[model samples]
Target: MTKRNKLVFAICAVIIGIIAGMVFVFFNQEDLINEDEAKAIVTERYGGSVEAVEEGADDDIYIVNVEGDTGTHKITINRHDSSVEAIETIAKPSEDTAADDSNTSQEQNEGTENDEPSEPEKTEDESDTAPSKKEEPAESNEPEILTVEQAENAAANEVGGNNVYSTWSGEGQNREYYILQIVDGDDEGALVSLNGVTGQVNKVVYLDVSDDDYGNIEQLIYEANTYADMVDGRYIEFDDEYFDEEEDDDYEDDED
Candidate 1:
């Protein structure tokens, strides 16, 4: 085909591919759980229409959430057969009347209090009948963060370093961790991370830095992780179409 025609063909092919993918997805959605059926099942048992229907990540089930005059409920149903798998009461709207009930309960409690005798004040002369219960100790609020010694030991055991060069603490996903620099053994140029709380080894990394990179080893490790993340993100998209010289030439000719 001519250059202009070839470019037109490539554009047409891309559009067709996108449309085909959309049609496939649309039809496949019809085979999954029906939201209408889920609503009907919830309304029959609970006397209310379903508020929302959400498909679960699991292939076989759907979550049907319902809100009614009396309460709110979460119902699980099978995707293929529409059978009820589980029902859970999430909230009770009926509890709104609790304020009026509480007032009546308070009046009754006051009447009972008037009729009952008060306990005599504790006396120094009278012996106590029951001993007071001891209070338990309060838990510490401080996090179980890793210490340098613990991090060094954990890294040493994993990488076989007799001594630690340097250490620093940092935060990981849910908790704190420590990275230790190792030397005097086979792990001379290795870096290791240890969990702050459990003292378990988290990661081991190596770096062969030149004189120009950095004298500070910790900064180099951080930069290495950042570079690795960048390289990883580059592969997240597979754009082989960019390398097609035929398409490029066609576009260049059309522009000219």
Candidate 2:
């Protein structure tokens, strides 16, 4: 063969090899994830609508796009096994006006107090409960117990509420004893930990309530359904409820 012809053939071979490599990478990538799992994972992580953007081959990966308040996320998954390979996020304007609504709700809640005398008295009663040792778990490693006054102050700072009832105490996995309870009607109280020797509220969760028995699971389900409709799918579950007589009795004993 002529030198020029041979050179041309070699160049063509190199180009073909490169093309083949790319094809292999694109086609032989990995496992396959079904549409349902992809959607569920995306929704849980990003809290939005997840739509399939691209499908993958038998051994290739699928790509999905999740739309959320902040932006859009591109998630790649293995086709054969349905595991996530990569995720890319793109910023976009928020779709839900939750922030604005939350602020308005807070303002309304604050303003309504001025029109009612019973509300202030109720708040005072709730706050006076104070942190009690009975709520502490038997195996707790609480270094120091917080005084009722200190607990009240901590709760107030965390959520602008004067009635911060200290309900339960236990050693959290983080090497701190957590004081847990309900605060405000819609808010979860907090988990305050104190220094070994200081009676102080070390940590606070403005809205952190634990799951209750949700008595008559059927009732809970009905309530959840009603709430879902009321909120128009904006909220899926009811995290708070009116204290049951039994629960109140339990609380009274604990308080004592």
Candidate 3:
């Protein structure tokens, strides 16, 4: 055979080998764990209902990021055999976890007023000497702004969800608007950043809520990333395995 014929045969052989390898891998692995089963396993092992469960890199494994009374547990399940691959426990639960941000901040700030130093009391002798300066009404120049209710309406209009709740979350410049939490209706559990002054809906962080369907999780993650892109804002975080950039780069290089 000519050199050209040999090259064609070699290319075809390589293609066939790749196809066969993929088929072998697929067939050897038993059925993967369903959403219910995966959650059950996580709860059994980690001692709580699974808060946030995700399929690991390319669906090869499953990830469960859950926090309980003990602490946070990140459990990995091999999709092939439906067995636990590794269990990592964090005693502190320091990461940007699945736990509600609103709840966390409230707990942190409730006791802050007590932590400040109290002012010293005025002595009877010094009180008489102290200047009795007359107080003047300050002039107001700030522009009229949207109310919290109006901001919540704007956020709900921007994203189709039940406007469950909203709170003044930040301080100073950071305290632009109410951080709105929408849930139950259309948008799973969305964290909407609403600009109270300008009445602009800024960023939204999509989150997972347990449902009968696993597609709920997929849609939550997809919207979380895609919607963030639409507004040029940041979305929610996922495990490293969920986005195996190295594996994707390798596949792209191979295709080229």
lDDT of 1 by residue, 1-256 (tens): 7999999999999999999999998887677667777788778877776778888886668798888766788999887777888989898876556666788899999999999988988786565765778899899786666666776777777767555355554554345343444444443355565567787665555544445434665566665444434444321222223336657999999999
lDDT of 2 by residue, 1-256 (tens): 9999999999999999999999887665433455676677667766888755667555365678887666778888765665678978876656357677678899999999876776334466677875656665578574555555565555456545445233333433223233334545644443343332344444443333334522343343333334434543321334445335557899899999
lDDT of 2 at 213: 26
Model 1, 85: alpha-carbon shift in Å?
96
What candidate 1 gets wrong by more than 4 Å, as runs, is: 1-134, 140-143, 162-164, 169-188, 209-215, 228-256
Q: How many clashing residue pairs appear in each of the predictions shown?
A: 0, 9, 0
Model 2 clash pairs are: 31-78, 31-79, 31-80, 31-81, 32-79, 32-80, 32-81, 33-82, 188-208
**Full candidate order by TM-score, most accurate first:** 1, 3, 2
lDDT of 3 by residue, 5-100 (tens): 999999999999999999987776546666667888777866865778887768777888777865778888876677888988856544455366
Clashes of 2: 9
Question: What's each prediction's TM-score?
Answer: 0.31, 0.28, 0.28
Query: What TM-score number comes out for model 3?
Result: 0.28
